[model samples]
Structure formats: structure tokens, C-alpha cells
Target: MDVLRYVAFATDASGGNPAGVVLDASGADEAAMLAVAAEVGYSETAFAVPRPDGGLDVRYFSPLAEVSFCGHATIATAVAHAREHGPGARDFHTRAGLVRVGTSVGADGVITAELVSVPPRSVPPAPDDLPELLAALRWSADELDPALPPRIAYAGAWHPVIAASTRQRLAALDYDMAALGDLMRRRDWTTVDLVWRESETVFHARNPFPPGGVVEDPATGAAAGAFGGYLRELGLVALPAELTIHQGDDMGRPSVLTVGIPADPAEGISVRGAAVPIPD
Candidate 1:
């Protein structure tokens, strides 16, 4: 299994989250995928096995365990696929659901990809669970933004959305990793979506993903998809609004995620970004 190491979100390799992409993993099984992910030591690794039906069966494995969906790996794998086969549309059957990706190269020679996420849904977190989550993150109720209430949102995976009133509160992240990981695993949450509103359609986010054995994700499309749902549910943005997500600035990776939310409630939101290879 040849692992293609690539960093997603940032044009330069050194500035984004690095992911392990196995372009061909026909011979590898679940055990092999787990082992390779651990060996690669990245937050997540993607294994793509081509199917006879012309689609691919994609699986995501973090250094610790398998996950339902991974945004960075999907972006990295799609870009890697486009680099070898020429930019175009592609499909993959992931653990979460069927995902479709469209790819193209710009005049500046940067490979860009936009993925239509599965239908998103949002629900309030269990009131009983919120206190535990708050404890793990050392967050008080007053620190939360009143406009964006806490909710558990899902597109491909579930995330508890927590909005801080200020960027300073979001930037000073010091959470109990083990405690939060335990809470997340028991509740089947993907990450803690800590965010700050910069404007009506622009926001800054930071995801604490201890369950994935990573401190944070530089660019998270799945979370962005769910975030759009959160905004729509709360009527935070106008109908048919386009949103921008700025993440990883605190980590120095500096990722930008674009979200296109349609007026229809059932339609999938679009997440667009560009990725490049990380030279080893």
C-alpha cells in the first residue's frame, strides 16, 4: 500500500493538515488500514479501493480508530485522484454515505475541489450532556454566543456546535483531551465545534478532535456542512446565503472553507476548497 502524503486546504504543504492518502489499497484490509494509519502518524488516512461498478469504496482511519467521515482526507484523496486522472467529477461510497466530488484546475495551476455534502440535520444537544461537555472544555455559560445556541449538527458525522462570543475565547483553547474524548466517544460525537462569529456570513472555527487522536483539524468540510445547517436552523443567515469559514489560523495552518447553503431545506450544502501535496 503506497501512501501519498498530502496536506489539504493550504496551497503550500507546510501550512495545512497533512493526511495520508492511499491511492490504491486493493490488497489491504481493515487491519492493514488501521496499521498504516498508525504508522503514518497523521490524524487520518484514506484508503480508496476501486469497485467494478466504476465507483470507489473509501474508508477513513485515524491514528486510533475508524471514523464515519473525514473531510480533509476526502479533499486530499480527490485532489490526488484528479492529479493522476485529470480533473473531473468523481464519486465514492464512504462509511457515512455516498459522496460526490467535482474537481478542476484553475488558470494559476491550483487544483480545486467542491463536494456536495449529504443532507444535513441539526438538533439540540441533550441538556444533561451539555454540562459534561462544558466541564471538559472548561467553558462557562456566559462565554457562549447568545445568537448561536449550542446544538448537535450532522451532515456526515455528528458534532456539538458551541459558539463563543469572542474570537479571543475561541483562540484560547485548553481542553481536557482525555475527558473530552471519553465524553465524545460515549456520545458518538465527531468533534467539538468551537466557533466565533465574525460577521453575518463569515465565521471562525476551531475543532477539538481528541477522539481522532488529533488536537484539531485545520480544515473540516463535514463540520462546515453541519455548520450551515446550524445557521439555517437558527435563521442566522438570510435564505440562499453563501458563507465563509476561516479555520486553523490559530494553529498557523490557515484554512478557508466556503459554504453554499441553498434555500431548500433538503438540499445539500456545497463545501469548496483547494489542496496540494506535502513533499516528504
Candidate 2:
């Protein structure tokens, strides 16, 4: 199988999060996929096998292990499929659930893909999980934004949503990798979403993905989806809001993620972005 490289959430290859996409993985087994993911060395790699029912059976793997779903990888895979087949709506059956993705060409002929996440939910982290989590990140209780209280949000994968009161606090991310990784493994969290709200409709984000063996994710679509749900669940945003999330600037791989949060709580969140091919 050809492993294609694509960077999602950026118009150019220099930005966004890089992901490996395997258009055809029908013959490969779990071990082979894991090996490929490790070789790719990205935050996650997506393997897609076309189904007879017209959908694709997709799986996401990090360097270390497989995950239920991944947002950036899904976006990359959708763009790759669109470039090869055509741009339109497609269904993906993942370990998490069914994810519906749609691709469209813009006036500039750039292809942008949007993925609707599975129904999302958020809840307070277990009492025992919060203190340890904060300690690992070296963040104090007062440093957190009281308005956007902490919660563990899930769209496809689980992420702990922690909002910082100041942008500087969000940018200064020096967490204990080993401690965070162990906590994430025990809690089944894919990443830690550290965010700072710029306005009612704009935000800045940084993701620590120690569990995936990734120091940081330049852009995280899954966490964006979960963050949207977190805002909606906590009544933090007005209904039918559009949020722009800026991430990876400190890492120098800036990424922009557009999040659409519908009014209905049962509806899935929509995360949209443009992806580009990474030169070989």
C-alpha cells in the first residue's frame, strides 16, 4: 500500500499537523498498520479499506497504539480520497462510530474537507484525575479559566479540556511527559486540549499528545470537535456559533481550524479545514 503524506488544517504543507494516509489497506493487518504508523512518525496515520456498502472502513493509529478516531487524520484521508476519486460526501466507519465527511472545491480550486464528528459529550474529570493532571502540567487551580470549567470531552476520542485564563499560560506548555503519558493511558485520553479564549467566537489552542508519543499536535481536529461540545455543554457560547481556533504558532507550524457548533445538542460538531500534500 502507498502511504501518502498530507498536512491537515493548513492551506500549505509547512503548517498544520502531518498525517499519513493509506488509501487501500484491505490486505494489511493490524500489525502492518502499526508498523506503518511507527514508520510515518506522525501524530497519527489513517488506514482506509473500501467497503462493499460504499463506505470506507477506516482506522487511526499513532506511533504507539491504535485510537478510536482522529480528526486531523480523517481530514487528511478525506482530502486524499477526494483528490483521487472526486470531491463529495463520504461515510467512514471507524472504531468510534460513523463519521460523515464532505469535500468541496473552493473558488481558488483548493479542496477543503469538513468532517462531522460523532455525537459528543463532556463531563467533569474524576476527582482523583484532576489534581494529578494539573500537577503533571504544572498548572495551578487559579490559572484555569473559571468560566470554561475543566471537563473531559469526547467526540470520537477522549480529551481533557483545560482552559487557561491567559494566553501566556496556554503558550507556556512544559508538562511532564512521562507523568502525563501515564495518566492519559490510565484515563484513556488521547490528548490534553489546552486553550485560551480570545473572544466569544475565537480561541487559541495547544494540544499535548503524550499518549500518542507525540510531543504536540500542530493542529487537532478531534480536540476541536470535543472543545466545541465542551462549550456547548457548559453554555459557554451562544447557539449556532462559529469558532476559529489558532494552534501551533509557538511550534511554528501554524494551523487554523474552523468549528461550527449547531444549536441542537444531539447533532455532531463540524470541523472544517484545508489540507495539502506534503512533498516526498
Candidate 3:
């Protein structure tokens, strides 16, 4: 199998999150896909199979297990496909739902992809889980931002959205891997979205993806979509807003994701970013 490596949400190869992309995995079974993903050993590997229809069937796998959806991997795959097949719109039929991606090349020959996620939803966190969640994160309730509150947000996948009261609090990330992993498995969470709002339109984020056997994800487009929905649902942001998310800087791999929220709350959120091929 030919596996392509690309970094999403970064202008340079040094930044953003790296993902494995398989342009054609039509003949590969579940086991084969899993094996290939493990061999690639990125946070997530995206497998695309061309369907009889024009759409593509996509699946995402981590080293340890398969996930319903992965944002960075999806971005990488779309950009890769565009580079090979000419930039345009594509529809991906994923386990989560039908995701539409639009790709374009800039004058500088940089490829950018925008994905519209499934309709997002948010549910309040169970009261009993708060202590366990906080304990696993080694964060006290006092450190949480009261305005943002706590909830499980879902766009293509579920993520516990936790906001820090200060940038300092968000930066100091130290958690028990086993404890957090177990908790996430029990809760069926893909990642924990830890965030600190810098302004009304700018935010910094870190994603703990222990369930995928990853300590942190540099840029998570799915979580960004869900976060845009969370803000709209809670009336935290004005309609038709554009929000900028800065991630992976703490890990020394800076990534930037732009989210567009429409006026209609039921509409899917759009997450846009640039992807670059990683040189072997």
C-alpha cells in the first residue's frame, strides 16, 4: 500500500499535525487497514476507497484502534486528493456522516481545504463525572473558566470541552495517562478539548487524545467545528462569526485553524486550514 504523509493546518512541514493518507484502499479489509495504520504510526491514518458513485468512502484508524472521524487526517486526505486530481469539491462518506470538503490552491501553490462537519450537538457533562474528569486532568474546579462551562461537544466525534480560566492554566498540562485513558474509554470520548480564550475571536487549544494512544493532537478540526457549535448553542458568540484557533504551539508544532459559524444554528460548521506534504 502506498501511504502518503502530510501535515494539516500548517504552512510549513514543521508545524501542524501529521497524518497518514492512503489514496486508494479499495482492496484493503479492516484488518489490512488497521495493520497499515499501525505501520504508519501517526495519530490517525485515513483510508479512502472510490465508490461506484462519485463520492469517496473514508475510514480513520489510529495505531491502537479505529475512530469514527478524524479532522486532521481528513484535511490531509482532501489536500492530497486535490493535489493529484485537481482542486475542487469532494464528498466523503464517513462513519460519522457525509462530510463535504472544498479544496483550492493559492497563488503560492499552497493547498487549502475546508471541511463542513456534520450538524453539531452539545450535552452537559454528567455531574458525577466532573470530579473524575478534573482529577484525571489534575485540574481543580477553580482553574476552570466559569463562562465557558463544561460539556461534551460533538461534530463528527464527541469531545469533552474544558476551558481554562487563564492561558497559564491551559499551558501547564500534566495528566495521568492511564487514568485519563480509562476515563475516556468509559465515556466514549475521542479527545479532551482543553482551551483558553484569548479574545472573543481568538482561542488557544490543546487536545489530549489518550484514547487514540496519543498524548496530544497538534490540530483537531473536528473539535474546532464542535467548539463553534458549542459557542453558538450557548449564545457565547454572535452569529455568522469567524473564530481563529491556535494550537500545537505548546508542543512546538504551531497550527492554525479557522472556523466559520453560520447564522443558522442547524447548519454545519466549516473548518479551514492549509496542508503540506511531509518530505520523507
Candidate 4:
């Protein structure tokens, strides 16, 4: 029942996104997890109970509700596990499905973790839902990139992909938090992937996670993975592409996520980032 807070995707303490983690949460129930997450007050908190099979039963919670999965929290948990039990592979039975996380520590004592998510999938955004999304974001139909039309993509969770016309458009993220939170709750979305294309393999993004009781997320690995699927599904980018997604600059945490998409649709996409501990 120990709580550890770690920030993923950045080496600096003040840089990456912070997530709360509980390594041995066998005694905590759903209500307990929710209360702990709310008290932690980060974007997300991870709870893991060691299983008899040597894996883990993992759950994620935001300040508002429980989530199916969370990448940053997973990364933090892996590093924390490695710190206590040494670096290795860890399996998580998440609400979304099975998640495999691996960790390694450098000679300099820096820890890095990578998570392989469940089978990813993507579909075009519902015609009816697009208008609601645009309204919530205060974006016009004409402002969309057109090349990257709206879609809902999933790795471990669902995120609506919305591409902005320019980097400037993506950076300015003033919106109605309460209204957007209501919309996300209605759709059961984890986050809105607001993006700008810097190149075929490079992008800049901002994730609005109002329903999580946060105005925005500094680093969003779930959205980044789903976005890789979105680009591949829409034929906006070629196969086996290594894409770079830069996020959190506007919020000052400045995180970077690297994703790889395979040629086959059935394969689970790979998302990689560096994680360092948030000092006690």
C-alpha cells in the first residue's frame, strides 16, 4: 500500500508528466483507489496487485473516474517496480485487456520503460459525433487539415483524432472545460487528440483531458498510439513509420513520445518514451 509518484517521458524532474502509482494495492478496492487518485490529484494514478501467476492486476483512476488504461501511469509503475524488484518484464491485466511492460536501468541509474498495448483499431468518426466534437473544440469544419479527417482510434482506450490546420492552431487551447467534460463523458472518450502535422513522420499535439478532472495532459501515450493507427488507417502516412509526437510545451512540461506502426493492422503498435523518478 505504498504510493510512489513518478513522471514519464522526460529525464528532468520538472519536465515530464507526473502520475501516481501504488505497487502493492491488494487491499484497496475501487472506492479506495478512487479516493487515493483524487487525493493524489495528478492526471492519473496506477494501482497494481501482484497476481499468483507472477503478473499483475492493474487499474487506473483519474480524479473523476476509473480509466481502462493509462500509458504514463504504466510507465511509472514499471520503473517503480524495477527500482524495488529489479528491471524486467511485467504483465498487467488491465480493464482494456492485457498490457506488457518492460523496464531497463542504465549504468547511470536512469530508468526507462516501454509498454506494448493491446491490439489497436481505428474507424472513421461518426458523422453525427463530428459536429458535436467540432462544437466542443470550437473548430470549424474548414479549419480541419482534411488530409487527416476525424476518427476514433484505440490502443488501450478510445481517443478522437482531430488534426489542426497549423501549429499555431494546435497551441492555442482555450475551451470550456465543463462543457467538454460533459461531452467526453457522453462519448466515453479518454482524450481528444489535437494535432498539427510537422511532417509525414513528425507531429505536435495537445491532449485535452477534461473528464479526468484535468484541463490538459502533459504527455498522453494512449492518444499518441491511437493517432498512429489513425494515420495508418486514413492512408495519411506510410506503413512502418516511426512517428514523433511532441506534446506538453504549452503546459511547460514538454514531453516527447515516439511511436512505430507496422504494415499489418493486427499488430500492436509500439510506443516508447523515457521515464525518470520524481524525487521524494
Candidate 5:
């Protein structure tokens, strides 16, 4: 199988999150897919088999394990599909759910993709686990933003939403990887969505993905979708709002994600970004 590499959420290859896309993996088994993902060594890789109904059955695998859904990988795969065939909309049946993704070529020949996540949802953080969680991250309760309370948000995967009170607090991220990773694995959390709201419609984010065997994700699409749900559920933004998330800046691989929140709470959130090929 051919493994194509692309960086999602950024026009340049040096930015965004790199993902391995296997456009045709119909013959690959679970073990084979996992082995491929581990060899690629990205946060996640996508393996897709085209279905008879014109859709795709996609599976996501990190270096360590399989994840239900991955936003950046999805974006990269969709753009790769568009580049190979043509720009259009298609459904990706993932372990989490069926995600609809559309791709379009811009005037400058840049390919952009948008994925509509499954219906988003959120729940309050587990009171019994918050203390240990904070201890692992070395964050105190006072460092949290009062306006944006903590919540476990879900679009395709689970992510704990933690809002830092200041940009400095978010930037100073020196966490116990082993401690946080153990906590996250037990809690079944994909990543810790550490964020700082710069303005009403703009925010900065960092994602620690221990379960995926990655220290941090340069641009996490799934967490971005979940964060949109968190903001909508908390009434932090007006209905039918558009939000911009700046991520991977502190890591030096700057990436941008645009989120569109609809008025209907039951509707899925929309995440849009661009993907470019990464040279071997």
C-alpha cells in the first residue's frame, strides 16, 4: 500500500500536523494497519477502503493504538482523495460514526477540506479525577479560567477541556508525560485540550495526546470540534458563530483551524482547514 504524507491545517509542509494517508488499504488487516501507523510515526494515520456505495470505510491508527476518530488525519485523507480523483463531498464511516467531508480547490490551487463531525456533546469533568489530573499537569485550580469552566467534550472522541487563565499559563507546558498519560489512558481521554481564549471569536490551543503516544498534537481536529461543542454548551459564544483556533504555535509548527457552530445544538460542528503534501 502506498502511504502518502500530508500536513493538515496549514498550507506549508513545515506547519500543521502530519498524517499518513493510505487511500487504498482494502487488503490490509488490523495488524498490518497498526504496523504501518507505527512505522509512519505520526500521531495518527488513516487507512481507507472504498465501499460499494461510493463512500469510504476509514480506520485511524496511532503509533500505539487505534483511535475512534482523528480530525487532522481525516482532513489529510479527504484532501488526498480530492487530489487523486476530484473535489467533492463524501462520507467517511469511522469507528466513532459517519463523518461527512467535502473538499474544494481554491483559486491558488490550494486544496481545502471541511469535515462535519458527529453530533457534539459535553459533560462536566469528573470531580473525583480533577485533582489527580491537575497534579499530573502541574496546574492548580486557580490557574483555570473562571469564565470557561472545565468539561469533557466529545465530537468524535473524548477530550478534557481545560482553559488556562492566561496565555502564559498555557505556554508553560511542562507536564509529567507518564503521569498524565497514565491518567488519560485510564480515563479513556484522547487528549487534554489546554486552551486560552484570546478573544470572543479567537483562541489558542495545545493538545497533549498521551493515548496516541504523542507528546502533543500540532493541530488536533477532533479536539477542535469538541472545543466548539464546549463553547456552544457553555454559551460562551453566540449562536451560529465562527471561531478561529490557533494551535502548534508554541511548538513552532503553527496551524490554524476554523470552526463553524450552527444554531441547532443537535447539528454537528464544522471544521475547515487546508492540507499540503509533505515531501519524503
Candidate 6:
């Protein structure tokens, strides 16, 4: 039903993570939305139904199942809405919580969207689950970064944050798809946030989204937001910091995501990126 394709977090259409946007899907049922998402076959498809108050009721669906939240799709949808309705602020009521998005056009005619996530929190992963996760990822304990440790972080969605001691380890991403998918489904994880810290403000990330039927996500804004929280919650980074995440380079569709962490621990993290339209 009139699906628009856009790549978020990249100025070029060939970069970033592609997402399907349905600006108006009020008439579609859950099954209909799911069918449409499958047809689009992107990592995620965002369906928006306008509310009477000028807000939107948004839902995200992958080819396989409905997701509580999706960052790149949200960025894509907000940018799409801005291009059609004019750049401004919009509120989205999602299954996870209320998300606030602000869009503006740069002098170069590029539109950037910034989303403030719901209050994020981080918790240590279940002890019993770490072994299975490590086995599925084919990573040894010694390969992990001692600073970041392993934890499940949640902003609008949940992701297990894993840090590699070196960029080389992070880049070697061969994993057991079936085992990871089964574990993710059982644990209800949206993605596995694999990261390598280049500096205090710079990082490289890769998201393995087996549950969504994707080998990897080029750019994952939700995971970035959650990672910001993870860093703040665990005192890994200074407060009121701005971090740059480089992702998808290994896949050749390079993407960049900017995350802003506030001083307040209870506040939501800000994820910002640009989305470009994919021509037909």
C-alpha cells in the first residue's frame, strides 16, 4: 500500500539502512501491515496512522515479525513526513512508548531528524544466557573488552551490548544464524549490538538482527540510543557527551549515527541522522 523507501543515517541513497515507510496505513490491519512489510522486505517497515491531535500512531514490522521499535525506520518516516508536511516536530506513539522527533533541512537541502527516545536503562545479562550468546557469536571471553562488559540495554527496544577489544574482532562477524536466531527469539532481543570503541567519542558498531530475518543491519539508531544509555548507566563515558558511531562499512553501505547523552540519568538519549530518498 504505497510504500516509500528511504535510507536513514546516510546522505547517499546507497548508504545507511533501507526502510519502508507507509505514511498512511489507518485502514490496514495487523495482518495487512505484516504482509506489506514482508512484501517490502526491508529490515523494518514503519506504518503511521495520523491521530486527531496531529501526532501519529506508528508501528514497526520486519519481514518476520512486529518489532516494538525501530530507529532507522523512525528516522526515515520522520524525514519522509517532513518532506511532505514540511519540517517540524512530530510525536509518535509506539508500542514501546512515546517518541519525539524533530526534523530540519540543512542548507544543502539535506533533512536531518533527531529522535529522543524513552528513558533508557541497562541491566546485566542473565548469567545463564552469556555462554550461549558467546558461543553463537563465536567469540571468546578474552576477545571482549573489559571496559564495556556485557549487558542488555533498552531505549525503545532491547539489545545486548557487546564490546570487542579490537576493531579486528568486531569486523569478523561470522556467526551461527540458526542458533543466534533461536536465542534471540527466546530472549526477545531486537539486535545484538557489536561494537568497538575507537575513542571516548568515536565507536564502530554492527548489529546482527537474526530475529528480523536479516544477517545484519547497516545502521541501527535504536541500538545506538540504547548503547548511549548503556555507556551512561555503566559510567563508561562522561555525561553530556556526543558520540559518533560508524556502521555498515564492512557491508559496503557505510552509515553514521550521532548519539547525544544528557547529564540526567533518567532522560532519554538523542539519536540523530539524515535520511535520503531511494529513487525508483
Give the per-residue lDDT of model 2 (tens digit) for 182-246.
99999999999999999999999999999889999999999999999999998999999999999
Maximum-lDDT candidate: 6
lDDT of each: 0.89, 0.96, 0.95, 0.87, 0.96, 0.97
TM-score of each: 0.97, 0.99, 0.99, 0.97, 0.99, 0.99
Error of 4 at 89 (Å): 1.7
Q: Tell me how far the alpha carbon of residue 171 in candidate 5 is from the true structure, in angstroms, after superposition.
A: 0.6
lDDT of 4 at 122: 82
**Superposed Cα RMSD, model 6:** 0.5
How would you order the candidates by lDDT, starting with the best?
Answer: 6, 2, 5, 3, 1, 4
Q: In model 5, which regions exceed 4 Å deviation? A: none
**Candidate 6 vs. true structure, TM-score:** 0.99
lDDT for predicted candidate 5 compared with the true structure: 0.96
Candidate 2 has a TM-score of 0.99
Candidate 2: minimum summed lDDT over ten consecutive residues — where?
A: 102-111
List the RMSD of every prediction in angstroms: 1.0, 0.6, 0.7, 1.2, 0.6, 0.5
Error of 5 at 39 (Å): 0.3
Q: Where in model 2 is the C-alpha error above 4 Å? A: none
How does residue 215 of candidate 3 score in lDDT?
97
Error of 4 at 271 (Å): 1.1
Q: Write the per-residue lDDT of candidate 1 for residues 1-280, one digit (tens) a residue.
A: 8899988877888676789999889988899999999999988999999888767789999999999988878888999999988888888789889888888899999898888778889998897899999999999999999989999999889999999999999999999999999999999998888899999899999999999899888878789888998788778899998998999999988888888899899888788888998876
Q: Put down candidate 5 lDDT per residue, 131-245, tens digits, no spaces.
A: 8889999999999999998899999999999999999999999999999999999989999999999999999999999888999999999999999988888899999999999
> Among all windows of ten consecutive residues in candidate 1, which has the lowest summed lDDT?
8-17
Of models 4 and 5, which has the larger TM-score? 5
Error of 3 at 145 (Å): 0.7
